[model samples]
Target: MRMCDRAGCDQPGNCPAPKSPNSPERWYFCERHAAEYNSNWNYFEGLDKEEASAREQAERAEGASYRQSSWNAWAGPGDGSRSRDELRALEVLELDPDADFDAVRKAWRSKAKLVHPDVRPGDEAAAKEFQKLQVAYEVLRAAEERRTWKGPEGTF
Candidate 1:
């Protein structure tokens, strides 16, 4: 087990935290240390309130692509098991909440063909729509793969 990176702490480090803003390096911390670190963490500690707000707004807009899909309209009642983002993917594909893999595949194929960049070259809207569709398909496909995956020979 990895030891917590905090000075003088001796515990299994299960939580990985970034060492600095946007840095690739990470520091591992035990649960207690991780909580302590997060309690004092700030995303815009150095920026003024206006700058921080602007930066936050920009980041939200930049990350809004997947969130803009149809799934936002049909987010399931909060049970905390399924994320809003995952439900958004289902909305993008126009599938029922409990749709099977086959249904997901069919919806993806039909939707993707309409907004393919090649089919609408120079159309920015089409390109963006295609990107959203692609993201949605990938999310659902990955979930399906995880559900159907089998570990080596009866071990799972």
Candidate 2:
């Protein structure tokens, strides 16, 4: 037999668990009291709207930082100063402007892998290189499509 912990309740039964977040180990309340306690409980009761908003923003920023950290961790390292445009231009030249779709795609994939930011996390150079690769791939792909659509000797 146990006593209900709520004040003014003398009924003998199992003591209800405490609903207070502050003293979980020491406090206990009967069913009705616990319900009341829970209804009034507020984790952010004292915070003003601005304060709450600021806290939320801070939390969001922290989350972004953590995500960046994780991304960097996975990416390993960053290239020093290579630019994406330069990489793309080099790739375009290497693949040959006249290369077919398969060749172009293969070249783009190889270049992308070599310069992807994730592959070189902290490297500004890698980021630049990767951008170049993307630009080159896009330009080449568009040109190839246009050439195909034009057909042999401008025929429909």
Candidate 3:
């Protein structure tokens, strides 16, 4: 086990403290020393108001992505599916990302008909494919709604 770097201390150094701002070197310290070091830490000491605010906002946005997701799975910024549901949805409908809603609907209808349970009765694979199409349509529809939704003041 590593010993604390604090002078005259013999405790196990379980916590790591950075030696300097943005430096790779680290100082291992015991819990008490670590707390003492952190108490004097100033993350925005050298930044101006605007710079500090921008950095703080960026950090919050990055960390909040985890909390914003419906589940604790790793999903992209929008449409909280663990997988890349948006791209997968587009692929399912055989449409490109730039395709409009009309194109999405058209493609979905065309492909869906081929796998639809009613058209391919008793075919388990086709039934599964139809389900995929339905899910893809739902994902795209929700995304479109989010893009167009205006809040209480009619502003995004």
Candidate 4:
């Protein structure tokens, strides 16, 4: 009988969770610990919106090609163009799903100014909201940059 991978647990290791996204390695845990690990895990921890979108597209392309999909169908974000994080960012800035990058920048500047730590000194709640807005803006900006990047002009 295999022992649970979680420290100090003597339960039988029956459930498996990937140690990291796209990794073959797994953590064998009892059912409870597996749930705990999954709840705490961020499957897209290091991925930006653009990377996520690309990955989703590739998966869909593979599906369209009728390849043996070991991973099953993907539950993509809204309209299959934006990532969940990007959607959340749009919500933060009160923008529509198809809003342009310029709109994102304008909204970010307007909202960030209201909750900025420098403007509202000593207010923990405002500081936290400001930080949230900053992260949302960054995610949107990076996605926009990625969308516009043209690498090396198609070398022959």
Q: Which stretches of candidate 1 lie over 4 Å from their true place?
A: 1-82
- Clash count for each candidate, listed in order shown: 0, 9, 0, 0
Q: For candidate 3, give the lDDT of residue 75.
A: 44
lDDT of 4 by residue, 37-137 (tens): 98888755789999988988988887763331111213222345677889999998899887878888999999999999889999999999998899999
| TM-score winner, 1 or 4 | 4
Question: Could you tell me every candidate's TM-score relative to the true structure?
Answer: 0.47, 0.36, 0.50, 0.50
Give the per-residue lDDT of model 3 (tens digit) for 12-102. 9999999998899999999999999999999999899999999999999898766544333234334444237777898888776566678
lDDT of 2: 0.60
C-alpha RMSD for every candidate: 17.4, 21.8, 11.8, 12.1
Model 4 global lDDT (CA atoms, 0 to 1): 0.79
How well is each residue in 1-156 modelled by candidate 1, as lDDT tens digits?
799999999899989999988999999999999999999898799999999999999999987764533233233323333456768998988887767668888888898899898888999998998899899988877765654555688323
Considering every candidate listed, which one attains the maximal lDDT?
A: 3
* Residue-wise C-alpha lDDT for candidate 2, range 99-124, written one tens digit per residue: 45676688779878887888889999
**Which ranking of candidates, highest lDDT first?**
3, 4, 1, 2
What are the Cα lDDT values of the candidates?
A: 0.78, 0.60, 0.81, 0.79
Cα error, residue 135 of model 1, in Å, equals 0.4
